[model samples]
Structures are given as C-alpha cells and as structure tokens.
Target: MANKRTPAASENDRLYGRALAVIRMRQGIPQQRAAERLGVTTQAWQNYEAGLRKSIFTVDGLSRLATALDVDPGLIEQVKGLLKEGVSEAWMSDGAQPLPTSGSEGKVVFFSRRAEPEVPPAEELAPVYGAVFAGKPGAIAFTPDRPDDWKPVHPNQRGYRDPFYLQVHGDSLSPRFEPGELAPAVRGVWPTRGQVCIIETHDGAMLLKYYERRDAQSVWVRELQPEPREFGVHLADIRAVHAVVGGAVS
Candidate 1:
C-alpha cells in the first residue's frame, strides 16, 4: 500500500515540483527558501522543483502554496502551460505548466492574495538560548534583544523570523505535540486560557502545557485538557512568557 501511494504521490510530486520552480524563478527567490516554506528538506525541495524527482502535490498542500505565492489556483496552471518540460516557474503551483492545452488559448495568471491561507501562518522560532529561559516576564533577567545564537531555520527564506516557532517537550500538551515532533510553536506573550504554552519549567524542563493566569503574579499550568484524558489540569507557575504557538487560524 505504501508503494502504491508513492507512485501516484510521485505524479503529484512532479507537477508540484514544476509549479514550485515556476513560482520561485519568477518571483526571484532561492530554492532553499521555498523549501522551508513547504516544510521540506532543502535538497528535496530543490530536486522536486528541478523536476529531478517526481511531482507530487496534495489539495491542501497546493492550497497552501497558492496562499504563499499570493495567487489564484488557475493562475498557476496557466503559467505552467507557458513553460516547457523540465522548465518550471518558481511562482507557479502545478509545476511546469503543459503548453496550451491542445488548441486552447492560455489565460494570464493575475497574482492575488484573495485565496485564504491554509494554516494560521508559518510558525515563528527563537533560539533555545535566547533571553532568559524564564516562562514569565517578571522572572526574566532583563535582556534587550534576542540571543546571539539565534538564526532562522530557513536563513535564506525572506521574513522567516516573523512567525513564532517553539520547541516542545513532554506529554503535557499531548495530542497537539509529541516528544519527537520538534514542535514548531509560534511566538506570543499573552496566551488565552487553555492554550498550550512553551516555557522553561522551574524544575528545569523546557515544556509546553495549557496555561492559566490566576492574577498578575500567580499562574497555573495544566495537562490533558480541551478534552478529558488520562490526566487533568494542575497548578503551575508563570515565569516568563515567550510566545503562543497554536489556535486561531485565519
């Protein structure tokens, strides 16, 4: 079944690759940067866009790409048609578009951002070493800027650091994150009740859990919520607030 899935996926991959290539080239962006936007390995993204690997794309994935390029779905298809095999548009969505569909005139691709974004946004990330490892503002050691160790995962991707990204640990925020997912949490200081928060546990664990504030100086962290599970919410201390990761997608 896995093999079967791969073949068809490869087809989508090919078309998907070509479309990405078209979009990147036209927009004058680098392949590595685009790879990060797609959450793919840089080399893998490059291979696909180069049409060296199969073109595979999912409706959800295509939709997301369309959102990033700020274009309509048809615009990608139309642009692809203008290119040759192995030739792809970095801004196009379906890979290299096949030429004028058998006696059909090509319509121009008008770029637009009307297409809704697939996810809230690409999450923001900060260096694990940045600032004080405090979970709340009061506990923080005054630091004016991000740590020197900070670097965007996709250094080549434009505005890569704008969205928040966090690393998570433990099962406190289970269902939403696991130990090995290398959670890419967004950045925010104020998290609504029951939202997962990434913070350095006073006990020395950098973990994520549902956070609640009792007052300015008091807060509690909980586990197994938003639904009943094996565990339940518990009291926690708010040390320093770094960012908010999930919920409220547009």
Candidate 2:
C-alpha cells in the first residue's frame, strides 16, 4: 500500500495537482497542450499540481474546468465535500493508485509490482538449519528480487522453469534469436519437431535450436535455416530438452 495524505480544503496540500492529473488523464489531454487549450501558460498549469493538496476554485472557473476536464460540473462540488470532510483521494478512488507513468509509444502508464509464482510461503517451507557462510551449500534460499548484475547459477546455460531464466549474451547463436534476448529455456516440456526448444546436451552444453527428433537416435537442430550440404544432424543423448517458448502464441 502507498502512503495516503489528505489535506483540508482550506489547506495548501495543493489538491489542484490531483485535479490536474484527473483532468489530463480523464480527457486524454497533454499537459502544455491542454494548458494552451485552457488559455493558461504552461507554468501556471504546473502550479495546479493535484497530488499534494486540497483546493478550491471559483464556481465559474469550476464550470469551465469541468467542461475542459470532460467531467460532470457537480464533480467539483463532490470534491469540495470530500476534501472538506477529510476523505482521502484514495478512498474516493475505489482502491486504485493515482500515478502517471510512461508506456510504450508515448502511452500513459502505470507501474505494477507483482508477487512471484509457485513460491511457497515462509510457513510452508522447512525452517532454516542455521545462518551459514555464503560459500556453504543451501546457504541462500529463494531470492526473487535478485540484483541486476548478479549472475545466475549457470554462466552459459539457462533454465526456464524451477530456478532458471535464459539471458542470452553472445552473438554466436544470432540470426534467428538476437543477443541479449532473455530467451528463457525452461525444463519440463519439450516441443514437437521444427519448434524452438532449449536443449541441454549430455556434455553440459546448453543450446537454443529448432529441434527435429527424426528418430530416437538422431537430433537435428537448426538454429538458422539450412543451406545445401549442411549436415545439421547431431547424435547425442538430449539429457533434457524442456519447454519451447516464442514459437507459438497459444
């Protein structure tokens, strides 16, 4: 939950900002551009910052404000009643955060912090044996919020599910999948022939290849489409060829 701050209507918590945000977001209007339409300078519009405080405007101004905001004129009256009566903006909002963030292609945005999947609660997991050294086995439990620069358990390989995400680094496997693409190779389910499958060999090599298990003895991997005389078949124990991603939508 976020911190909630409600100001009296007479106070300078500057509820104007919230009003401005609502006005801009509700009407789908840009800031400076909306200011121009309202015949107010940009800085003057900035002074109407909404999140900080409660505010009041002239009845006539409120009428024009409602028109520009594309909201009911009575909304101003409602704001007055709620702000004066000490109701939090969040309360009237019906439990949604009021923050403006950016989206792809200059779209309005919101931030989300979702919890991890399949992780057991502290009560569900076994208790810790002891606070051991960093080098000790089983020293570190599940840490979902890993630091950005921290390397995974495997430097060259990746696992898609159950403690794995493939962060592709070098360009050796480029042309089909680009470098730096987080092409996570999960274990558990392998795809049918000619689909993207993250495979691990018996020799401890991890690879992203389109798989074709022609028979039980042969595995044909085509990272890139083949040309003439390109013998793409490699015979090996597939060890694990779990999970295909990005090849199909459903």
Per-prediction CA RMSD (Å):
18.6, 21.7
Badly placed stretches (over 4 Å) of model 1 are 1-115, 118-164, 186-188, 201-204, 225-238, 247-250
Give the Å shift of residue 106 in candidate 2.
Answer: 44
lDDT of 1 at 89: 42
Q: Estimate each model's TM-score.
A: 0.31, 0.31
TM-score of 2: 0.31
Per-residue C-alpha lDDT of model 2 across residues 1-250, encoded as one tens digit per residue = 9887654344433454554454455345667875775677766566555432223265666655555554435554544444444545543342122222223354443222221323334333211111111111122222224423322332112112232444443333455455444443334443444455555556445555666443324555554423312123344655666434432110
The stretch of ten residues in a row with the least summed lDDT in candidate 2 is: 127-136
lDDT of 1 by residue, 1-250 (tens): 3554323344445565666666655444577766776677888776766555543445555555554443334545644544434332433333222122212233332222333323323443344332332223233332225433343333211222233444333344556665334333433233334555555445433445565433322445566634443322222643344334433211
Q: What C-alpha lDDT values do all the predictions have?
A: 0.43, 0.42
Q: Please give the distance, in angstroms, between residue 149's alpha carbon in candidate 1 and its true position after superposition.
A: 10
* Candidate 2: regions farther than 4 A off: 1-163, 170-175, 225-236, 247-250
Candidate 1 clashes: the total is: 47
TM-score of 1: 0.31
